[model samples]
Target: MMKSIIDILIYAHDGRGLGHVSRSVAIGLAVRRLFPHLSVLLVTGCGATAELIGEGELDWIKLPSYKTKISCGKSCGDLGPSNIDDKVLGTVRAESLSDLVDVYKPKVILADHTPQGKHKELLRAVEGSTDSKWVLGVRAVVGDVDKVWSELSADTFTSRYSDILWYGDSSVTGSSELDKLSKHFQKIPFETGYVSRFKELRNIVTDVCTHKKLAGVVSIPWSGEGTSVLLEKVAEVLGGFDISEGIWKVYMNHRDPRVCGVKKSFECHPNVYLEQLGPSFLTDLANSRSAIIYGGYNSLTDVMGAGVPSVVLLRGMKDGEQEEHAAILSKSSSAIVNVFPEDEVTVEALRNSLEKCLKTKVEPSNMVLNGAANAARYLAELAGVRDANG
Candidate 1:
C-alpha cells in the first residue's frame, strides 16, 4: 500500500528582517526530515530569501516583497496602515496566496506570526478551504504584549481567525511573555525551541579561540535599519585598532552594500576581510574572536550555542523585543553591550564593548540548543508522525 502524503504550506511574512523567512525554512526542513514523503510548500515575499531557498526539497512561491516596520510588534512598513500602496500590494499578495491554497489544497497551513493576505479575505479563504489544519508558528519573543494585543485586537484579522499557536522557542526562554499572551488566545503553545538552521559543518572546530589568529566576524544585514548603522560603527571602531597585529574578518549578509559605504575603505585593509554572506555563518562565529551582531534570535542562539561572546545592537525604531532577548542572553554572560542603535552607539562605546566581550567568558547554554531538536520532534508528533528517536 502506498503511504499517505502530508502537504504543508509554510507562510513567511517578509516585511521586516529575514528572521521569519529563515525560521520558516528551518521548520520546513525539520518537517521534511521527519516525514520524507511530506510535500512542503514555502511561500515567501523576500527575493533574497527566495534565493537562499533556491530549488530545495520543498516547493516555493514568491509573493510581493514588502518593507517591514516593527514598532512594538505592530508591523507598519509595507503591510500596515502607514503605506498607501501596501493596500493594493496586500490585496494582490493575498489573492496570490489564496490561489496557491486553492490549487495546492494543503492539509495543513502553517502561518508564521501574521496571516497572509488581507485580514478578511485571508480568513475567508482559509475558512472556506477543505479540512485544513491551521497552525500559527510564533517565535519565542514576539514583542510587548500590550502593544501587540491592542494592535491585533483592533485589526479584523484577530477576531476572525483561530489557530493552534505553535511557539518556536522554549518555555524556559519565553515563559513570561507566552503566559501573558495565553490569557487572550486559545493557543497550543508548544515549544519548538530556537531553530538554528546553519549546517553543522563536520571537521569544523567548535572552539572560537582554537585558531591562533584573531579575527572579528560582524554579521548584520545591509539595510538602512539600525543594524546597518551599528555594523558601520563597529567597523569604524575596529579600524582604529592595530589590525596589523591580528586578522579582522567582517561578514555581512544582505543584498545592499551601500548601507556599509561609510566603511568602504576598510574593505581594503590588509588585516581586514569583508564578505557579503558566509555559507558557514555559524562556523565563522565558532572561529572568530568575537562577533558584532544585530539582535536576531537565530544569530543570538547560534552564538550562544557556540559559546562566543557578542556585542548585540538593538534596532532603535522597532519594538523592544530584541533588547529583551539581548538582556536575557547578557544575564547568562553570553553577550555584551545590549543597547539601542541611536543611543551611545558611537565608535568609542563599540570598541569598549567589543574589547569586553572578547575578554569575557561565555559558557554555552545547552538549554536552547537541546530544546530545539526536541521541539522539532514535538512538531512531528503534532503532524501525526512518529519521532525518530522514539
Candidate 2:
C-alpha cells in the first residue's frame, strides 16, 4: 500500500480563466499557514500559479493546458473547452492523478467548483483512492440557480462526499439557494462567508490620503479573457465624466494588461493611471470612489471584502456563475449593483449603476471577509490536525 505522505491535495482546474486557481492558492496558503507542519499539494491548470504563488512553498502538479469557452449552461452554446483526447493525454492525466492519490494518500482532498473535474478526470481517482476524506468547496454564487441545481442533482459524487464547503456568506446566498443545495447534498454544506486575501488597506491613514487625492477616480478591474468589449466601452464613455486630475485609475492584471491600448488611452483624454500587475489591488479598490468589475468569484469577493461601492457586470456564461454572483451581490448589499447585458454595457447604464453603487449600504454582516481563514480552519479540522494556534 502506498502510505499517506501528503496532508491535503487540491484540484484547481480552469478551462477559462484564473478565479478557480486563485482561490485554490489562497486556500492552500491559508492551510499551510494555519497548519505549518503538514505538506499541502495543489494540482492546477492555471499556468500562472508560480507567478501568483511563490515557488516551492507548496508541492504542485500542473496539468496540460486546455482553452475554456463560455457557454450558457441552459442554452445551445457548444460545451466548454475541448479536453485532451482521453486516449492519450487524458489517460495519462487520469492515471497520473490516480497514482498520486493512491501513492501519496493525502488525508484530505478539496475539489474547487466541479466535483468531477474537467471531463470527469478526477472521478475515478477521487472515488477509489485512499482513506482520504473528500471535500467539495463552492463559492457563494455559482451562475444560475436552475443550472447549478440541475448539475448538482445529476452528480453522484456530491451527495456521497464527506464534507462540502460553501465559501460564500449565508446571507448573500440566502435560504432559497441553500434549500436548493440541501436537497442534493442531504445536508447543508459549511458556509464560510466571503473569503478575502486582504487585511485592511495597507495603511489606512495613507490610503485615505490617496483616495482624497483622486477624489473622482473610479477603479475598473476586469477579467482580461472575456470583458474586452465592456472594458473598451467603459473607457470610451469616461469622456462624459469629470475625471478629477485628468487621470483615471485602471488596474493591470494577467488576463488583460492594457485594458485600452495606447490609442484608446489617448482618445480618453485622461492620463490613464494603470497600476502595475504586482501591487496589492485592495488598496486601489479601497481608494477608488467605486469599482466597475466583472462578477467573477474573486472580483466580487474583493469588491465586497473591501466594502467598496461598485457595479457588477456579468459575463453570465459558462454556467452562469457570474450572473448568479451578480444577483446575490445585488440582493445582499446596496453598495454593489449588477448591470446586465455585458455585451452591450453602455456609458449611461454604467454611469447610473456607479452612482447607485456609490451610495449603497455596507455589508449586512462580516461574512464578506470571512472566507479564507474559515476555509483554512475547516481544512485543518478535516485533516484531524490539532489546531496548535488555539
Candidate 3:
C-alpha cells in the first residue's frame, strides 16, 4: 500500500522555552481549523507538546530532548548529560526526520525559530526530501540583531528556505532590522502579525472556571531553580493587597511544585483566590480589570490584543529579548508598565508598577491578530490547498 502524504509537517525546537512549541501548536491548530481537509503533523522536542496541542488534534512525533547551550559563543544543541553523545543524538534525530519525510512525504514543512534546527539536524531532512516547500517562522525580538543576521544570512538558511514568516506586529515589535535583512537576502518574510492562542487557551480553561468574570489576574510564567527570589518578591508585594472580599484572583503555576516561594497552601493576602495555571489564565486576564503578567511574546501579545491594561514583568534573559520587547511595548502601547532587571525587582517597584498600570486605560493595538490563520493560509497556498467555496 502507498503511504499517505502529510499535508504539512511542523517542527519546533523547544530547548529554550515554551515559545517554540507554543507557536508550532498554534499554527498547527490554525491549519486544522482553516483547512480541515489538509492533514498536519508536528515534530517537537518539547514534552508539553501533547498538553499544548491537545490529544488527537494532530499526530506528532516527539523527538529526543535536544537542548542548546552557548559557551564561548559557539554551541550546537545537544541532549545534555544523556547517555548518548551529542553527535549520536544529532544523527538519531536527523535519521528520524529523514525517515518521516521519506515515508510521509509532506508537501510543506514549516520550521519554527532555527532555520536548520538544532545542530543542523533538520538540514539532513530538508536535503533528503524533494518537492516540499520549506519555510522558516521567526518571532519578534529574536535576541541580538547581529547574531540573528549572521544565522539568517548564512548560505545554509539562504539556500534552503523558500520563504519566511514574521509572527509579530511591525509597529509593536520593530521588524525593521529583520525586514532589511530579508530584503538584502531577497527572501522577505510574510508579516503575519502576532500569533496568539487566546481563544484556544480560553477554551481549555472554561470547564474548570465557573465564573464568567474576574476582577484581576496575575500570572508568573517561570519556576524552578533560579526563580525563588523573584517569586518571593512578587509574593511579598501582592501579599499587601486585601483580597478578603474575593475581588482579586491569583493564578499561580502549580505545574512545577518548586514554583519558588509561593506555596499552594500559603495565602498571604485576604480574600484572594489562588488557582493553578490553566488555559483560562489568559481568558480571565482578557476580561479582568487589570493584569500582572510575565513579559513573554505570547503573553504580551495576548494581553495587548485584548486591550487589557497590564504590568509586564521581565525575566531579564541574557539575550535582552524581553527587555527589547518591553521597551517596544512601552512605547507603542500606553497600557503597559514594564519592570526590568529581574533580579532587582523589589516589592515597592513591582507594587508601584502594577498600581500605575491599573490607572492607565486599556488601549489595544490595532495590529491584526490572525497570524496563525495567515500563516496557515500561506502554507495552504504553497501546498495548493484551497477552499471549494471560493
Candidate 4:
C-alpha cells in the first residue's frame, strides 16, 4: 500500500507588494511538482495575487488585506486604519484566519515574511495542531534587523514557530551576521536560491521600427508613496530627453485595473506603451534594450539574469535591503547603477547610465543561481517525499 504524504500550507502576506505573493506561489508550484501527491494550500492577503496564481493544483484561501510599512528604516509592521481602532482590525484579522484554520486543518504551515498574518491567529492555530509542522520562510533580504528582532521577540508566535527557512543564498549574508542571529534561535538557514515564478514560454519579441532608441521603465506596484513620486520624476526626465523618439514601456506587476489611470499619466506618450501585468511580463522585459526599475530582490535578480543592464531606483526611506542588494551588484564594474530616492533622476543622468551600460560588457553571471529546481528539492525533502537513499 502506498503511503500518504503530509499536507503543507504556505502563508503569504501580500498586502501591496507582488514579491511576497510571487515568491510564495513559486514555492507552492515547486512543492507540487516535486510531490505530486502532496496537498498544498496557499493563504494570501492580496486578491490579485490569488488570481495570478489561479486555481492550479494547489488550494487557496484569501485573507483580508492588511496594510504594512517599514518603521524607522529597520522593521516592518502593520498600521491601523485612520478611522478604525487597532483592536478592531486585529479582531477582524484573527477571526478570519481562525475560521480558515478550523476548516483546512493543515498539517504544516509555512509563513512568508509576515509574522502577524491573520492577526496572529494563524500562529495560534498552528500551535494548537498536534501533528502540524510550522516553518517561517524568509527571503535573503530583510528590513532593519533591530526592528525585526524587536517585533519577532514581542510576538508569542516567534517562540512557537518551528524553523526559519532563508530562501535566498546564505553566502550573501556572510558568516558573522548568520552567527549572531543563530545564537538567538534554531535557524534552519537554507539557500534555495531566488524564488522566481518565471516560466520560459514562447519568446515573442516586439519589433520597434522607429529610428530612435527605446528604453523600458519598470515600476513597483503602486503601494509605496515614494515609488509614485519616482515614477513622476522618471516621466519628467524622459520627456526632457527627447525620449519620445524612443519607446518607453511602463510595466506594472499588480495588473490591477485601477492602475490604468496612473499608467496613462506616466506611460502615455507618443512613443510609450502601457503594458498590463501578465505571465508574459518577463518576456517583454527580455526583449527590452534597457530597463529602469525599483529595487525588489527577485525582480532585480531576474533582470540581471536576463543579461540586461538596469538603472536601479532605490526606494528611499524604505527597507535598506534593496539598496544593499543594488550596492552589492554595483561592485561588478557597472553591472547596475544605484540611484538614491533624493537624487534627481534627470534625463541626463539616466541617458548617461544607459550609455555606460551599452558600452560596458560586464556579464553578471555569478549572481544567477539554479533556484527553482533547488527550491523544489528542498520542499520535497521537508515533506519527506524524497526517494530513499542508495
Residues 1-390, model 3: lDDT tens digits: 234498899998766457778878888888877787999999987766775665326678888776565453333455543557777888888889889888888888998876677656788888777677788888877776343456444565677678888887786666684666576556777888778776444433454342425546777654523456766676676666656313456765565556624563347556456766555565567667667777777777767666667777766556677788778877877657664665667778887776676666766557667787788888988877665224
Whole-model lDDT, candidate 4? Answer: 0.58
lDDT of 1: 0.60
Task: Name model 1 segments beyond 4 Å from true.
Answer: 1-6, 50-58, 69-75, 78-84, 115-121, 145-174, 199-214, 225-232, 253-257, 333-343, 370-372, 387-389
lDDT of 4 by residue, 106-158 (tens): 66677776554534545556545555556666666675644345555335345
In angstroms, give how far residue 91 of model 4 lies from its true place: 2.5
The better-scoring model by TM-score among 1 and 2 is 1
TM-score of each: 0.81, 0.79, 0.84, 0.79
lDDT digits (tens) for residues 169-199 of candidate 1: 4434546766755654545466655665543
TM-score, candidate number 4:
0.79
Task: Give the whole-model CA lDDT for all candidates, comma-separated.
Answer: 0.60, 0.63, 0.70, 0.58
> Stretches of candidate 2 above 4 Å error?
54-59, 71-89, 144-160, 199-226, 239-246, 252-268, 275-279, 355-364, 387-390
Considering summed lDDT, which 10 consecutive residues are worst modelled in model 1?
A: 199-208
Ranking by lDDT: 3, 2, 1, 4
Candidate 2 or 1, higher lDDT: 2
Q: Positional deviation of 372 in candidate 4, in angstroms?
A: 4.1
lDDT of 1 at 389: 51
Task: Itemize residue pairs with steric clashes in candidate 3.
Answer: 243-270, 243-271, 244-270, 244-271
Worst 10 residues of 4 by lDDT: 200-209
Which stretches in model 3 have alpha-carbon errors above 4 Å? 1-4, 54-56, 67-88, 145-147, 151-153, 199-215, 224-226, 244-276, 387-390
Winner by lDDT: 3
